[model samples]
Target chain A: MYIIGELINGMYRNVREALAERDASAIKTLARRQVEAGADALDVNCGPLSKDPVQDMRWLVEAIQSEVAVPLCLDSTKQAVIEEGLKACRGKAIINSTTADTDKLDAYLALALKHRASLIALTVDKKGVPQDKERRLELAAFILERAAGAGLDAAELYLDPVLLPVNVAQNQLEDILRVIGDFKLLTTPAVKSVVGLSNISQGSKNRSIINRTFLVMAQAAGLEAAILDPLDQELMRSLITGALILNKAIYCDSYIEAYLKSKLKS
Target chain B: MAEELKMITTWSQAVCEMRLGAGRQEGGSRKVTLTVGGEETLPFLFKEGALPHTPLIAVEIFDVPQDDEPEALRRDLRGISKDPVTWAKAMVEDIGADLVCVKLAGIHPDGANTSAGQAVNLVTKILGAVDRPLIVLGCGEAGRDNEVLPLVSEATKGERLLFGDAVQENYKTLTAACIADGHNIIAESPIDVNIAKQLNILISDLGMPLDRIIINPTIGALGYGLEYAYSIMERARNAALSGDRMLAMPFICFVGQESWRAKEAKVPASESPAWGDQRERGIMWEVVTAMSCLQAGADILTMRHPQAIKIVKSEIQELMKKAQS
Candidate 1:
């Protein structure tokens, strides 16, 4: 599993305070910790607290990278903010998302190609998050079509089924999983899939269990990457075990340690 | 809608590439060295991955002469059976062995019980006689091996020999000696996959670089648990290609040692004429066993009979030839 650490996002109090205060050390610590905790990349988001999202995105990207040299997922709803983050990134970056909306996808695909970055395309548009599998697959197909039209490499695109909170959208969870698997069949070299993992437990009790369970199920459905908390030891353990069960990892007596070492080497 | 179907699968990692011997330029006297592993896909799926090295054959010669023997082997090795140096020479110069494995069998408590000094002296002579790289193995007795291997490891210090049969219960002394003397060690495990990986880890934990170690996932002769051994090897190779570094080392199968021990290989035509010519049956037994091992991802095969070795070598050449696309 490709783990993109979500702890660096401004939704967390520490991250929000650090971004507001321009404290490089605080942001650097989170970046270093996430990588050590087996994160393949870090997600940098300058949440609602930022007065100047673009500059803060650049500063956060620069600060975190100066401490640890891992790829950053430039997370923001706006294309311009994501563009700024991409500029400050020294390594390949992942654009946290674009919607199925044709205009937005065209822009994101062009921007991704321009910077040689990966873009996460969510199965959402003006119609809002799909309540069923067909709509999600339709939106996913639309994004793939636009990406192909723009000459984007399918490998550089990640399709997310727009995971919704389980408490409110309980009936749609199964459809989301089927769509995740369905997206693979629509292209030659299938586009990769990822999810904002924590969204599964939003406003729910027993959040960690729900998130861990959902992550494993999604992994079985071929989710290749996920935006998640690597520091959550239980969730990370489940991810490692899930990969092992899927034969994506080899079993050793200390497989968890082996997984972490292999992750670090790559 | 009818659509074209495609099978798109790929492995993210390849087995670690390892070199067995060193030359004068690299501080060893051998004229040739063998490199193995580096398969990015399953055995012989040439279209999917690069198989940079072909499977190699090593002829096994013991430190002591064999008096009590199988007629099939004694008939072939009549004169050379009494001396290790001649045996090593014939294996490399005549039999065309890619490498030679010197089994210090006499050092075992049940055998001649040869002293460590005697074993080291025999190894040094074999090293001098053959220009090919050597694989030095200790007697099966752990206590004697512990006492003997380090001395031989020191005496042949820079030869870059592949030494082994280091098991789960005892690996430290040899691992340390190999590290000090700059030789590679073989980590052996029973048929269990977890134990095999654990042994690799234990050996690596003692500061031995993983690539320098080979895995000896123990095998049985054909018709005697060969399928089980094949399954274990398949699982290990698959795991290695799936990004498991600890299990990613190349495999070494003892085709001759196990194959010759089978009852079918030993029983003569006089006793079981229905089994056909004894020598031909024995050679075929070894060949079939080696081929199965190679198909199941064996990188190095330690075999005995020259006829069997000749057949397997040609078959390997045929398999290594990828079709032009």
Candidate 2:
């Protein structure tokens, strides 16, 4: 289970506040806690709300990397932020995403290949998020092909079959899983599947529980990387257990040990 | 040389892996851990594949009966009938039930007219009194069940509680709660294999693991339509063993609900002398119904009568031993 700690994102009130004040201490604390809790990577997201989004992303990448040895996942909608974050990161980072859009795909793939960074590809194109599995899988394949065309290894691509909120469309749950499972079959052994873990449980009460359950189920369906809040003990436990059960993490005797050593720093 | 039998179906892949026990140290506070969905082959076929864990048995504890129960049950349960907490405790402590399934009959509109908070309190009392894993059930009233399950789930977080009758229309709240609370859910559909499969798919889509789900394909009493339920369960097991991941979870049955509701178990001795002793007859009715379902594919049986539960437990032990050998 490759946990991309989602704590550095500017979504939460605390994180947004920290970003606004440029509180490096707050940012470092969040990053260290996620690493101690079990995140393999810290996802640094500087949203458009920031005055200098690229410079803020660069500052976040540098601060988080300085505090923790774990890799960084450069998360941003803007290509400039991605470029800055990638440059600030010490080692190879995961490009938070690219869509099936031709221009964005070309730009994101070029940056990822140049930086020798992995990429998270959303299964959506110019129109919007696909409503069916076939379309999502088609979009994912296109992204994979485009990445390959850019001279990036297939293994570097992580497909995100975007999860639709259940409140909006109740029937979309299975459709997303079908897309992931079929994508697993369609892609080569080198390719990996990932998802924004919290999206499935968004808008529903008890988001943590739903998010944890979705993580386990998605892991069982062959999702290797998950963009998630790694500081959550329950979520970390579920991910570690799911990984062990699925034979993804063979070293740990039990989920407890797996989590303690891999996710928990202490 | 012995005759060579040709195999009709060839399964080369592993169907379902046995679920590890989920409880307190594993983030759940329950004393006994639940191990579900460890079928290497399908529901039952010891010769074909591995069935690691024995199907769990849960004793039913209702809030209060709508009407007078059968004389046999009335005799044993008369003392605790007034209070659900005492009744649930009696089922666990006295009856030696493996699991206590607390049915919130009070939540049903025609019953106590209890609010969701009352249901939550009752479930909390049951959880506090008993150390065993719980299966909190509703009166099968959709509106009431949907209302109560979420409250119950929130109140008993990390207990690994199993909740039920999550139908298509109102599973969101309950399923979401189960996910949040680290509990399990029962996806109930009519006794049709296809409907069962579809419901499982729907719940799984919500991100509930296959192991956390228990499929209730509805149930039938012995003289009513046991064969239909049995056939459907068998088919479901077949589909699971054949690598259909959707139908892989353990099967749960409303044994007591179905058997007690049937005419054979409810009617008095005076009305049916040919049925033998009413106590013996009613016990036999529940026992037979549960046994038949277990043989077909039921992995969890919620039973009523103590005598019937004893018989079913012994039979399960025998089957488990036979499978082990």
Range of the 10 consecutive residues with the lowest summed lDDT in candidate 1 chain A? A257-266
Summarize candidate 1's per-residue lDDT along B170-205 as a digit string, tens digits.
Answer: 899999999999999999988878888888877877
After superposing the true interface residues, what Cα RMSD does each candidate give? 1.6, 15.0
Fraction of native contacts, model 2: 0.00
CAPRI category for model 2: incorrect
For model 2, the stretches where C-alpha displacement exceeds 4 angstroms are A1-266, B1-22, B42-44
Tens-digit lDDT track of model 1 for A101-195: 88888888999999999999999998898888888888988888999989989998999888889998999999888888899999987889999
- Model 1's interface RMSD: 1.6
What DockQ values do the models have? 0.55, 0.02
Q: Tell me, by DockQ, which candidate is best.
A: 1
